[model samples]
Target chain A: MPILSVKDLQVTFDVRSAGSWPWTPPRKLHAVGGLSFDLEPGQTVGLVGESGSGKSTVARALVGTVPASGGQILFEGQDLAAMSPQERRRHRKDVQMVFQDPLAALNPRMTVGDIVAEPLVTHHPETSRAEVKKRVGDIMERVGLLPNLVNRYPHEFSGGQCQRIGIARALVMKPKLLICDEPVSALDVSVQAQVVNLLRDLQRDMGLSMIFIAHDLSVVKHISDRIVVMYLGRIMESGPAREVTLRPRHPYTQALISSVPIPDPVLEKARPRPILEGELPSPLSPPSGCVFRTRCPKAKPDCAEPKDRIQREGEVQVACPYQEVKDALAV
Target chain B: MKLASGDAKLLDETAQLASIRGRSLWADARGRFLRNRAALLGLIVLVLVAIFALFGGYFAKYEPDYVDFSLMGANAYRGVPSFESGHYFGVDFDGRDLFARTVQGTGISMLVGVVGALVAVVVGTLYGATAGYIGGRVDNIMMRTVDILMSIPFMFVLILMLVIFGRSMFMLFLGIGLISWLDMSRIARGQTLSIKNKEFVEAAVATGVRPFTIILRHVVPNLLGIVIVYSTLLVPQMIIFESFISYLGLGIQEPQTSLGALINQGAEQMNNGTLWMLAFPLFFFLVTLFAFFFVGDGLRDALDPKDR
Candidate 1:
């Protein structure tokens, strides 16, 4: 069974005014709109796209940090949207997040031990102090922290160490589903591989499930089982990681993949790489019909008309007027 | 061999636990604080002032305002120093010891300064923290109120308070504390706004840490260094206000000497050509005020995280 599933998740942020000036109205921006996805036990699903993809917004809403405007979040066949505060607090013990910025994410004043032990102490307050200390030490060791160094403050540690502190903080509970929101985005290039490899080993060893959010497709392809492509508060494409990386159908995904520098000179010179034509349309008032239609080279007159979403390639789906245009072109 | 292995493990565990309590927080703060030369000097001077206050009463045989006729004219035309051997600072016009009363005035001035500043810091922290953290219209309203209050002349307000409360310590506290606390509130509000949304605070939220505890534990610790620096800086300001009220005779009454009130008393000695009366008390107040200023500046420079 899927460990967690989200159906038509919508979150809209009311930025500023509550009332209307005749032309302006309220500046209600749609940060995430009608997005849906799922994760099974012990699986890592990578949500990949460029910046402002609403990828992080979806992750935050799943962890219940951001309030949902509409839709259901099912965790272990239970509706998270309907859960009471007490039930939600209990549910959160099994799912947690490690945000992108390490120094800002971890409290600067707290010792590494306290930051790691906080979740354990909070959720399982009944645990004895001795056990809590033991658990903190064990997790610190598991995350490659020197046991003697646990009392050091966050500022004393480097960026990568701070991220390790963040990971230890999230992993101490041995949570079933971890939300890694660009965990390596803020780290040094050399340290990125170490942190990524550590997470991969921990997931495999602990049978952990995660929804890894990142703009780095290459990094996502390394560890993710499946990939979900997001574009301007909506999912544009999702499929098996290798298939999506090798042969992307969506124009945005194609631009993103080709931009990933090819090491081989022959293929790098040969492929007809499409450079992105324009800036991503603003999420606040996205283009009607298919949101990506304005940016798609294959846009048709019918693409200007809303082509209600269509299913393609087994369970994969695309909303485009040119679905049959590609067919008619005999490619 | 198995028993020996268990004993080694137990020893290692005990050492690990012992390391956690290697130093108390008090000891750490104190050690860091003492390394700062200015804080050390400020602490020493403050302690010495307190010591003088406690013991000055025991060594005094005469009242601070004692009037004696026999020695009154003795110094009038002596053409030499008068023979009052025990008065370290020579006598005043009425043959009162300038030394003994100056010593007495330190304690009273301190009592006023500390009590007044405490009221200021407490009121300011609460008011500012509430305004900044609650934010929006509430912050706007409260800050406007602060602006209105800041514009009114503080001395006029002090005199008004004096007129209402009749020169009591309560009135002195109310007069100075109510005015000076505005600065504290502003500092606290700005600092609180920056820190109240940090991850630890969010972590506290996620863990079901109550709102009040979050403010007290998380918010307050981050503000402690700035608060301490401001508190020291405020002492001299409070002393100056107390001095002003007392100098104007709107502070502590007769026989209850403040440095301010005594400065007024010493001015009488100056009017009668007794320079010793004015010199001793003025010198004492000057030394204390300068010391407080130096300490305040040193603390501001030293405790600043930016300086590091």
Candidate 2:
């Protein structure tokens, strides 16, 4: 059974009018509409999407950071939406998050020890100060940070080291689920690989389930067992990482895959880069039926009509109506 | 079980961390502050002034308010400070010890400045932190109230408070503190608004750390640099305010003297050419204000993360 299951999770934000008219009704912006996913224990699910695709909202909603407007979030068979304040707090201990921009994520005023010890001190009040100190030191070392630097402030560390500190803070709680929201996007390319590897190692060692949200498909591909592609608050395609990257059915996913640079110059030249047309439409007024229909090359009149069905082709599930026909024609 | 295995490795690594000397943020800030020459000088002067206020009266042999009729019989009631007469500083028009009264005034002025600034810090910190942390509609309402309060003339509000409460020390302190807190609260609120959104606060919330804890530990501590730097600036302003009010006869009435009241008295006697009367009190007040300014500037530099 999946350790965490989200069913039709919806999140909407009310954006007030920028104009002076107070009587104007506030518009409801659908950030994430009817998003669903399941995370098996010790599994890494990569939620890949461009900015404003509501991928981060999904991660935040699961952690209860951003409140869900509708649908159910089931963790260990219990619905998070139904949980009381006390129960939700208890649930929070099992799920922890590592944020993007490591330096911004940490308190500049705090020492490394205090930052890592916060989770333990908050959830496990019974733990002694000495034990916390000892544990923090251990976690720091595990994350490749020098334990001796416990007293140093966040500004003293480099970007990569700061990220390691962020990871140590997240892992100290012994969380079953770790939501990494673009954990390496702010970091340099060399540091990105280091942090990603550290996360992978920690997940293996701690049996942690992860939701790695990122815009770069290549970055998530290495860490994720499964990949779910999102576009303007809706899922475009989802399947095992290998299958989705190799045999992308959705035209949107195919375009996204082609956008990633291939290292080999010869192969890069041979690759058919479907340069997507038109900018992403605002989430405030998304296209009817298929949200991506406006930019979708294969979008037809039927694609504009309301459809609730999600068709499965092989291992991947695609929202497009003519996905199978297109795949058969390609063969 | 897997977690325990990882923790076991952590225990072994603990030995390596013991050699590192942990430097607190305060200790680091202090180290930087000490290196600043002007700040160090200001600190020394402040310490000397505090000692002088506490015990300088004891240095003078005569009582602060003792009137000497014998001194009036002579060609001059106010005598130049002479060791033979045991008068360290010349007698005032009332034949009171100028040195002792000056010492007494130091205590009163310092008390008002320190206490008033402290009150401002407390109220401002709480008000601004709450406004910034809560945010949204609550923040809007709270900030609007601040704006309304800010729009009112400070002196008008102060005089009204004094008129209602009477010109007691408590009322004087409250009036100064109330006015000073407006700026402090605004600075704190702006800082809290920025810090409240930082990922550390979010991480604290994610870890189930309560709102109060987040404010106290995360929000307040980060604001200490600006708060402390602003506090130094506030002390000098408070002293000036006390002086202005006392000069107006609305503060520090007879018997108990503030530097402001002393300066007011000295200014009246300036026509008589008793330069020392005006010279000493005005000099001390100016010196104290400058000390605060120097220290405040130094602290601003010291506490700035950019400087480090």
**Standalone chain B TM-score for every prediction:** 0.86, 0.90
lDDT of 1 by residue, A146-246 (tens): 76666777777788988888888888888888889999999877898998899999999889998998898888988898888888888877777776777
Clashing pairs in 1: none
Q: How do the residues B1-308 of candidate 2 rate in per-residue lDDT, one tens digit apiece?
A: 99998998898777765677656667888999999999999989988888988999878988887877776634144466677676776766667777888898888999999988898798898889989998888888988898998898988777777777887888888788777888889999999998887878888888888877888999999998999999999898889889998998888867788999888888887777566677777888988888999999999988997876
- Model 1: per-residue Cα lDDT at residue A215: 92
Compared with the true structure, all predictions reach lDDT values of: 0.76, 0.86
Cα RMSD to the true fold for all candidates: 4.7, 4.6
**Candidate with best lDDT:** 2
Error of 1 at B248 (Å): 2.2
Cα displacement (Å) at residue B222, model 1: 1.7
Highest TM-score model number = 2
Q: lDDT tens digits, residues A216-292, model 2?
A: 99999999999999999898889999887777788888878888888888877875666789888999999988888
Give the C-alpha lDDT of model 2. 0.86
DockQ, structure candidate 2: 0.56
